[model samples]
Each structure stands twice: as C-alpha cells, then as structure tokens.
Target: MDTPTQHSERDRSSEPDTGPGERSRSSRTRARIASALSWRRVLGGAVAATVALLLFSSYVVQPFLIPSRSMEPTLRVGDRVLVNKLAYRFGAEPKRGDVVVFDGTGSFVREDLDANPLTGLVHGAAASLGLAEPADTDFVKRVVGVGGDRVVCCDARGRLSVNDVTVDEPYLYPGDTASRAPFDIVVPAGALWMMGDHRSRSRDSRDHLGSPGGGMVPVERVTGRVDWLGWPPARAGSLEGTGAFGGVRTPGGAHG
Candidate 1:
C-alpha cells in the first residue's frame, strides 16, 4: 500500500545510474577512434613508414631503373632491377659474369660531385622511391674480370679472354663482336673490369681505359649485385649471369 509519491520515488531510485562517469566512459570510447585518426598520430605513422622504407632501400634492396639501352637484349629501357645490397656484404666477392651496380663518379664519369646537401637528400629520397633518375654517375655492368685477373680483348678468334683463358660469351648482342676496341690489361687487386652485354652501345670500363683508375671499378665502390628483374610484369624472372667463365682458371691457376 504505497502512496503515489512513494511509488514515484522508488521508481526514480531504481532507474539505471547513468551519471557523468558512464557518460565519460562512452565519450572516451568514441574519442579512441578519433584519436587513431588524428592528424598528428597519422602523420607520425606515415613518417615511421617512410623511414623504414628508406632504410630498407638503402641497406637491404633497392630498385634501379634502366634508362638506357646499354644492356639491351637482357635488360631494356624502363626495366627495373632489384639490386641486392647483401650480395657482397660479407666475405663473398664479385665473381666473373655477375652483373653489378657501382658509383662511377671517378672511374667512368671522371668528375666529382659538388652536390648541394639539400639537393642530394632530395635526389636520394626520390631515387629511393623510383620516381627520380639515379645519380648521373651510377652504372650497371657485367664483371668481365675480377681482381688479379688478366683481361685481354680479341684473341685469334677475336674473342675476349680472362686469366688467359678464352671466354665464350653467348650473351653478347647479336652481330656484336666481343670487342672491336682492343685492350690488354690486368685487373689490379680489389678492382673489377666491367663490360656491358651491349658492348657496342655501352661506355663501360673500356671507354675509360686511360683514366686515373685505369677504368677499374674498386670493389669497395660496388653498391650491389643485380639479382632480379622487378618491373614489366611479363619479364619477371631470376636474371642469370653469363656463365662463360666456368671453365676459366682462377687467379691462383686453379680451375673454378
């Protein structure tokens, strides 16, 4: 037997307690989503991702764009190659027939870069993204001779020979002679003699024979070895090196 006022009071007392704290909890849950989408948080995430990508591109693997026909029949213009930075990072050496990328500033280009710091940074960032051209001094070529090897162009059969052994190059472009420009030289220790598949069109170590470095690329300056073709969906495959030196003797006179 309760009065109307007493019943109303009990109803009010039994009502769910939706106070400021409950409201605050709901507001916090809603804010969590906004916080995740906040400009500052999103910007931080993007910056972290960019840094990781740059680091990976710098020291792990990098995509190099081919802008010339120097390696035609194998790599074409607009083809992108994945350069494996770890290929020679350890005690492993660059073997004959391996394709490699190196900085050619002093050896091939014969000019030092007086680059502005800001411009260099911007160019690096763009190059890492594959949006800008690699440095004008970057070069990709095949290893015709390694350290302590004698490289001679044009034997009796007009073929290039390494370590005094005639090399049968099957990867040379059609109708292209091993080399029309004759040369006889020994690769100094810790250096490499590079040539392009399209020797006729490429300005490789042969073109800088008389330069200060004797057209020799220092092993220390090698950036990485080209491992695979990355772009042009139809051309994706593991790139095989010119295996002409399998029968050639090593620098120690031991056949490898």
Candidate 2:
C-alpha cells in the first residue's frame, strides 16, 4: 500500500485544479451578480417612491404652480400653492374669501384638451412637481360669492358687494380697483363666483357674465382650496382668508 502522506498528496492533486485565471473569472461573475442585484434594489426603490408621490398628489394634497398674473399681489407667477384636495369634501363647502383651484371646463374653457397624450403626460408630471403651469383649463382664484348670493361690481363707493354687503377687500392689488366692469348677477345654487386679487388683469366672472353657465364655476368643478404658499422658502406660509366676507350674511340672509 502507498504511504499515508503520499496517498493524501495524490488525493489533493486528483481534485480539479482551480487556476488564477479561473479564480479571476469566478470573481468577476460574482461581482456582476452582486452589481445586478444592487441595481434591481435601487430601481425598485425608485419605482416605489414614484408611485407613492403620484397617489399622494392624486388624493391628498397637490402643489399647484401659479400660471399667470391673474392672482398676482396674493399669488405671483412661479409661486406654488398647496391645494387641500379634501377641503370641500363630505359636507363641507367652499366659503367666500377662500382661494380655490377649479377646472374651468364648461365655464371658462370650451372643450379644450391636450392634443398629444405624450405631451400631456409630460406636462402633467412637471405640473405635479410645481415646475410647470397646470392644465390650460385649470384656474386659481378667490371665491368672491357663493351660491344664492347677489354679487355686484362697482357699488357707489366703487367696491364689490356680495348680497348687498360691501366687501372690504384689502387683498386687492395696489391701485387695482374692485372692478372696472359692472356686473349684477345672483350666483346660482351650487355655484361660486370667483375673482382674482389682481382684478384688472384677471378675466373672471365679470368677463363671462353673458356666456353659458354665466361665469359660474360649479361646486363640483372645484378641485381644492389653496391653503398655503409653498414656494420661495422665504415667503412660505399659510394663506389664511382675510375675512373680507366676515360681515356678509350667507344665503337666505343667514349670518355666520
């Protein structure tokens, strides 16, 4: 029989030899597998984050980029406002003096729609990030009169009045009169009369008084209430109503 030590050496040599080249290839393969796994994990995390952001923006709150100078003194162009999606939900309704974001589909725009789906998607994504203006039909203005209220522009004192109660609008842009255009209309039930702080530059209820819907934005079209200014870190804060309508009575002569 072969010596014990000799037998052990022979057994070691009998095993498949793993050369430096083979070892190097094995290491590279392991490294590639590890890198792929790391990349998959990273991709999964990114996808999850995007889904969460979309859901939150769709249901909870959305950042709205101010598109024009319509709401200027109070909300400037390039400013982003935080819209509370559930503000008018359930039994609640938008009150006078509240800034709101609504789709002006039938009231302001006439069947306006994005022609290209890809462009729409890109714009929508950018809008959600507050980097681009919202859809063309989207409007942001303050609620000047709610349902069942008689809104008149340019009273004897050159001030707007709601239900005959002259509103004190301290929020109006400097030197901008309440309204140069005279209008007298009773807001229909389940509708709102919206106007911008920068009345002179804004084309609001007064502009569409003769059109269908009579410049009335339906309550259902209101997407949310603007509750906060979220852009320009130095100017970020809650956008509380100025209580311009505090003295005004609700519909049917009810005081609140």
Candidate 3:
C-alpha cells in the first residue's frame, strides 16, 4: 500500500518532463540555422554569377555605349554596340571599313593614364555593360587604311581613295563630305588610319596627323570590332561589313 504523496510522485515521474519553453527554444535554434544556410547559398550564387559575367565580358564580347554623335546616323548617341573582342584574334587583322574600338593612348591622347584602381574597376564594369561612358583613351572609328596602304582624301571626284581605289562611302552621314581637310599619307606597317562616319563632327586621323604616331592607331591596340547594335527596341540590327572597300587592294597587292 503506497501513501497518496508517494503515488503522486510516482505518477509525475512516469510522465515525460519536457516543458513548452524548452521545445520553443529548440525550434527557434533550428530555424536560425536553416536561415543562415539559406543566406550562404544565396551569397555564393551571387558571387559566382558576377565572376562569370566579368570573365565573359573581358575575353569574348563586351558592350560599348556611343558617347557622342561622331558615328551618328549609323550609331546614334545612347545607342549600345556589342563589340566582338575576338574579332582580330588568332592572326586575323582588322579590315578596312570595319568599325573598330581601340585604345587611343599615345596616338589620340598624349599619354595613357589609368584611373584609380577602385574607381576604374567600377567604371570599367559599368562601361563593359554599356551602362557608362568608356574611358577617355578609348575611341571608336572606321578603318580607312591599314599597313602600307596609300590613303588620300578628296580625289578628283571629291572622295577618299585608298591604294589608288576610290571608296564610295554610303554610310557617311547625310550630306557630309568624305573629308573637308586635305591629307595624303601612306599608312605605316602595323598601323591604321581611322576615320569617323560623321566627318564634320568627328576629329579622327586627320586631326592628329601632326601628332606622334601620325594619328595612326596601332593594330595591336585594337580592342575589337563593332558587330551589332543592341539598344533601342526600335533600332536593333547587325552591323554588317560593307563592300565599300572591296575594290581597294591589300598592302602586298593581294585582292581586298
């Protein structure tokens, strides 16, 4: 025979002693762990995506914004152009009449100066996405002559001539002349003569003829060719190479 207090004690001990507070605390701890893991996964994915984008833009292709109207009518201000970084890679060279982007340091500009690393990184990333203006040393232009070709402006027909072959530029801005300034120079080996489609508004090779490198952009400095216009839903199309320079001969007399 057990006493009443002993019976009560035995009953209490037989039942589970877990309290609501303890279960609530344990649930909260598990929730925190799950949340932490989720955040880590999200952060890791973001980092990987950024790295992939940067690498693709640096090596394969990049987007460039048209900062000015120098290439207007063909490339308008605010227009975004996709540049093919590998266009001239693997022993290929930039052809005449191709719209190219290059670092104009030591040619267009007196010197090549880099921006602060942090600022440069930010701006470069933005510019690569066509969301910001390119560096001052970067320029976009058409290749009029390349490597040992004789380039003369304003022939008898008021046209630009390359290697004695007159070029009929259909892409020039409406009512704009081939060149208002007179110039005659033979493009040096491994150099290029660049010109703008909007002759009146652009300062191209002719503007720097007296400067160092004779205003000729080195072939090595060429970044890429403009292959597509990718902005403004109303005006998006491929920038195909034209036959304007088809009749011009290569430096070594090879058919162009």
Every model's TM-score = 0.84, 0.93, 0.89
Off by over 4 Å in 3: 1-18, 112-115
RMSD of 3: 2.8
* Steric clash pairs (candidate 1): none
Report the Cα lDDT for residue 115, model 2: 72
Taking the candidates one at a time, how many backbone clashes does each contain? 0, 0, 0
After superposition on all CA atoms, how large is the RMSD of candidate 2? 1.7
**Across residues 15-99, which tens digit of lDDT does each residue of candidate 2 receive?**
9869999899999999999999999999999999987887787777899999899997899988989999989888799998899
What would the per-residue lDDT of candidate 3 be over residues 21-61, giving only the tens digit for each residue?
88898899999999999999999999999888878988889
Task: Judging by TM-score against the true structure, name the best candidate.
Answer: 2
Cα lDDT tens digits, model 1, 1-256, are 8999999999999999899999999899989878877978889999999899889989999889888888877888898988999999989989898988899878998675576879878997878767777888788888888888999999777699887788988888888888889999999999999999898999999988988999999999898999999889899878976668998897776664
Ranking the candidates on TM-score from highest down gives 2, 3, 1
